[model samples]
Structures are given as C-alpha cells and as structure tokens.
Target: MQLRHFQNEFPYLVKALLSAKKAGRLSHSFLIHNDDGKLADDFSISLAQALACTNPLPDGDSCGNCVVCKQLEHRTYSELFTLAPVSKSRQIVIGVDDTIPDTMRWFRSLFHMKSSMAGGIKIGIIYDADCMNDESQNCFLKTLEEPPPSSHVLLVTANPFTLLPTIRSRCQSILLLRNKTSYEDEKIRGIAGIMWELMSSSNKISTAEECAFAMISISDNLEKFAEEKADVKWDRIFEDSKYLEPPAKKRLEKQHEAAISAEYLKMRDSMLSLIHSWSAQAYMLSCGIPRDSIANPELFPRDLNVISSIDPEKAYRMMRKSEDLLQILNWNVDTDLAFREFCMGVEFGK
Candidate 1:
C-alpha cells in the first residue's frame, strides 16, 4: 500500500497523514475504521513504510524503491510488529490470546532501545483491533497511555464501535471506503434477486423459512469462494517451502488454516452487509422515495414492483431489526440463530 494507491479513493486522509508527517506533527496513535478490510491493511502498511523509509519524498511519503520499503515488502523489517486474532474457527467473532498486554509491554521495552534502523521509528499495527477482549483491552490501555516516543500505533478494524470508548478517545480516528469495484457484481445481483423474490412471494410470513435457507446457501457459497482464494494464495507459499522442517511445516499449515477461516468470516460479514444495504434501499423505496435518488443502484437494480407492495412502517421496523441482528452477530451470537431471527422478522407486501 502506497500513497498513490489511496490518492484517489481517500485523498483527504492521505493528504492529512502525509501533511502531518511533513510537519513533524504526526500523531502517536491512530484508529482506522471502515468497511474495507483490504484497504485498511494497505493504509497501515503505507503508514509504516512512510515512518521507516530511509528516503522519503517532500510530502513525507515513502520512496517505494528504498531499502526500507523493500524490506517492508518482504516482511523482514525488524521494527514493524503486527498483531491480529489467532482464531481457527469460522465464527464471526474471534478470540485473541490474553498475553496481548505482555506483548505490548515487550514492544515498549524494545522501543526504549536504540533504533534498529536510521529512521528511528518503531510501529505496532493491530489488525481486527476490535477482537481484543476486555482483559486484553484493559492491559493495552496502559501502553496507550504512556507510549514510547517516536513510536506509532495503528489499530485497524471494520467495527470500531465495538472498541472501548477510552481507547477510541485516545487516538485519531479515520474512516475508509470500500472500493465499489471490489464487490462481485454478479453475486450481488443474485442476492438482490432473492430479496426481491422473498418480498414478492404470496405468503410473506411463511416464506421466512425459505428466505432463511436461501440466505444460508448464499453464505455457504461465499465461504467456499473465500476458502478457494486462500488455498490459491497458500499453495505457492507451501510449494516454495517444501523442504521445511516437520514442526515448521506443521505450524505453517496451522497458520494457513487459521488465515483461511478468518478470510471466510470476513467475506461472510461483507455479504451480510450487502444484504442489509438492500433492505435499507427497500425501506427508502417503501417511503415513496424515487429510485434514482437511492444509493448504490448499481449493486442491485431497484425492484419497484416489490418495493411498492411493502409497507413503509413494516420495512422501517425490519431495517432496525436487521441492524440489531448484525449487532448480535458481532456479540458472538450463534450465526444461524441470529440470521434466522432476522429473516423471520422481515415483512413484505402488507
């Protein structure tokens, strides 16, 4: 991730961060929240590179060809540490080890030592930052309060609301956008078709079970796609390390599996959000809003026929219900049960 990549999508954020760096007034910590996980990851990487680069541009952006930048690309930079969840399950909510505090303490200790490179900056990036449990978060607060000089912390998460208030208040928050082209247009159309059909069905109440099943099928297909992508990514890595020691190979395999599972959950959540967006549009349509005025019509053609039949009051109620279900999912409620409840609550054609 480099400044050029986000210059168009997030011009303000890019300019702000770089300007701060150039002015020698960069914040010690930042909390980045957005629906785009990939972009958030890239942004953090770019920040790290800018801070550690030996040759920076006048705007404080990293020179992509520098030795520090190359080392970062190879993941061999000694001063850049990344923290993330270590879940092996396909559950939406993941668990992190209780030793995060210890990790942070050790990181601080390292920062106190002489800089490893000439840049004299140590970076700590926490991906899926919201996954930290209460105990771990409490522990992390200590380090946040008295962070080392010349140290920068980046906390990246899609759901920043789940993070503790104190933690959020201590950091500058930035929001990012999900690139429109990143979504699969065909899959979105399919999901929208299902929603339209469910709304137009003769027996709205009875169709709950049917709609629930359809949604599950879509979710399953998405998970499979995520798994295939992860496999393709890891195949080359494994092939290159065929002569690795037995224990090392086993560890790598485990890590690979966990990564696949995490990717699946991330994809699943994004799919669900797509569905929710459709419902939101349906609600707007129910309220006599013009179709052309609706957001994201490209993702799904507005189903005027079905939308006309839905009760505005009922659609509003269901919209709120869907949001509640999303919160429930974030709280680690059983995915199947929560989704079922949401499907059952959705009402069409009053």
Candidate 2:
C-alpha cells in the first residue's frame, strides 16, 4: 500500500520530486508523458498520495500510520481526482464531448470542497491527456491557467504531441528516462498482466473467444478512424511499442521465456491493426456513413452497415464480447497462434 509498490514499479515522481524538492523548485502544472499500461496510472495515483499526505518524510514517503494514508490504500480519498480515456466499455472516444462544461463543473465543484481532513492537498490527475481533443484541451487550459494555491494537476500520456501545443508549453513536463524507469515500459508486462488473469477463468475457450471479438471491434474502429482522419496519428500506440529499450526489447524477444510464442506476437500485432480498423468504423458509424461505402481492404471498415443490417444489438454485443476477450487475453496466452482460435470464435455472419 506504500509508495514502494514493487521493486520494479519505481513510482517515477520520486526522482522528479527529489530533484525539484532539493532545488526548491516545483511546478504548479505538470504533464507526465510516458508509455501506457498501468505503470503510469499506478505511479500517478501514488504521487497524488505522496503530495497530498500531510504526514510525509523528507525523502518523499507517506506516513503509513495516518488516516489519509489509509484512505489512499483503499481508494476512498476525497482529495484525489482521476480521469482517463473512455474504454470500450463506454464505447465513446474520449473527445470534446466527454470534457464539456458540465464535466469541468463536476470536477471543479468537488475540488471546491474543503479537505475531508486537515492539511491534505487536493490533486487532479488525468490518465490520458492526449485523449483530449483540441476543444477539450482548451477547456482544460482555462482550469490550468488559474490553479488553486493548494492544488496541482498531473497529466499522464504516452503521446504529448497530440495535445495542444499551447497546453504542452504551459505545463512542466516529466519525460520517463528509458533505462531509469520501468514506469514507462508497458509491453510484455502489460500483455502478461492481461493474459494471466484471463487464463485463470473457468472457461478458457469462451474467454479466448471474447478477446478475439474485442480486438476486432477495436481494430475496426482504429482502422476506420485512421481512414476518416488522415491527420490523426496513432503515433502513441506505435510509440508505445517502439519505446521499449534494450531490456523491454529483450523481454519482447524472449516471449518464449514467458510461454508466449511468435504467433502470440503476431496476434497482438493483428489486434493492434484491428483496433485501427475499429477506429475507422467508429468514425464512419458516428458520422452516419455506410460502412460499405468506403470498402478499401487496406483500410479498416467494419461494414457496420452490413453487420447492423442484421441485428444492431447483436453486432454491438459482439463488440462487447470482443472487449471481454481482450481483457482475458491480457493474461498468459501463447501470443503466436492463440489468437487464431480467438478470432475464429468472434467471426460472425457477413
């Protein structure tokens, strides 16, 4: 429950804060850029605890004996605010719509309240800053322009370039050093985390089926999104893949050590492509265009028109199943050929 989550989990802000604390320098606004997986997410939350804790060590550790410390361990702390991109569960791309005036109002209203206990700092953390659209970023910019005296904003993202240039310039940014931090490496470890959990289920076949379906849904949307918005860059996903250094790269290469095969990696690649496809499909469907109108094999088109032509709810269910399967696949699975069975399970009528 403490900041020392794991030996490898180096909650990042330790070094950053140490440098700033020693230099007697701290920023009112911060944008933390790094690779995905829960590493950055976990680190961001821990940093919030460390910052808000009234009882903290000079070495930047929280006093585990305090009420605030107990609150953080159980995720019931009032002073902490967390926002992240919409998952497949929401079926909404995290865009301007998600960050409306009402949304900001909701968060601001919460922050306006006094701390539940004495001497705790209020903290705001966004899990994916890059997911915010231009307008939404503009909306947030106003919030950052006038942060509270006892408040700090920490934004986590794999791709900061997608953020508004103005927004990037305003915040103090923390870049995860390659060798220095595993907080940014979300490769094999991430996939492993997902797969191990899935393999533990009572029905491995159904679990695998769900993963296959979810990947297709994700791929369809990503592909469609790419096609519709050429200006859009999935630079983050690829950057996430590329950010792997010698150690991470070695881990990926040593998939066999983890009981993952080459086929598993291929399926993972296919899963990425499928998400790209789903992006394109999502854009088209949202825009009221026929899925078949833009049928380019190189492009990702869910043919949502065709799929929904039969049963819209059924098709949507498939997407949900796909998401479920992906979650299960996150655990220990043979990356090489495991997805073939998964993809086949999710294949539906044309």
Best by TM-score: 1
Report the lDDT tens digits of candidate 2 across residue range 118-166.
6667788776677766555777777788776588889888755566657
- Residue-level lDDT tens digits of model 1 in 1-350: 56767887666568778998899888888988767787777778888888878889997899988877877777778877767765553112322443343244444455456676665678888788887776557767776898866788898887765677678778876656554423463553576777765655654666877777777777658767777879888999999889999999999989998988897877776676776667776776787766765556654455667457876776666655665666666776677777677777665422
Q: Candidate 1, which ten residues in sequence have the lowest lDDT sum?
A: 89-98
TM-score of each: 0.48, 0.45
The runs of at least 3 residues in candidate 1 whose Cα sits more than 4 Å from the true structure, single-residue gaps closed, are 89-119, 179-350
What TM-score quantifies how close candidate 2 is to the native fold? 0.45
Return the top candidate by lDDT: 1
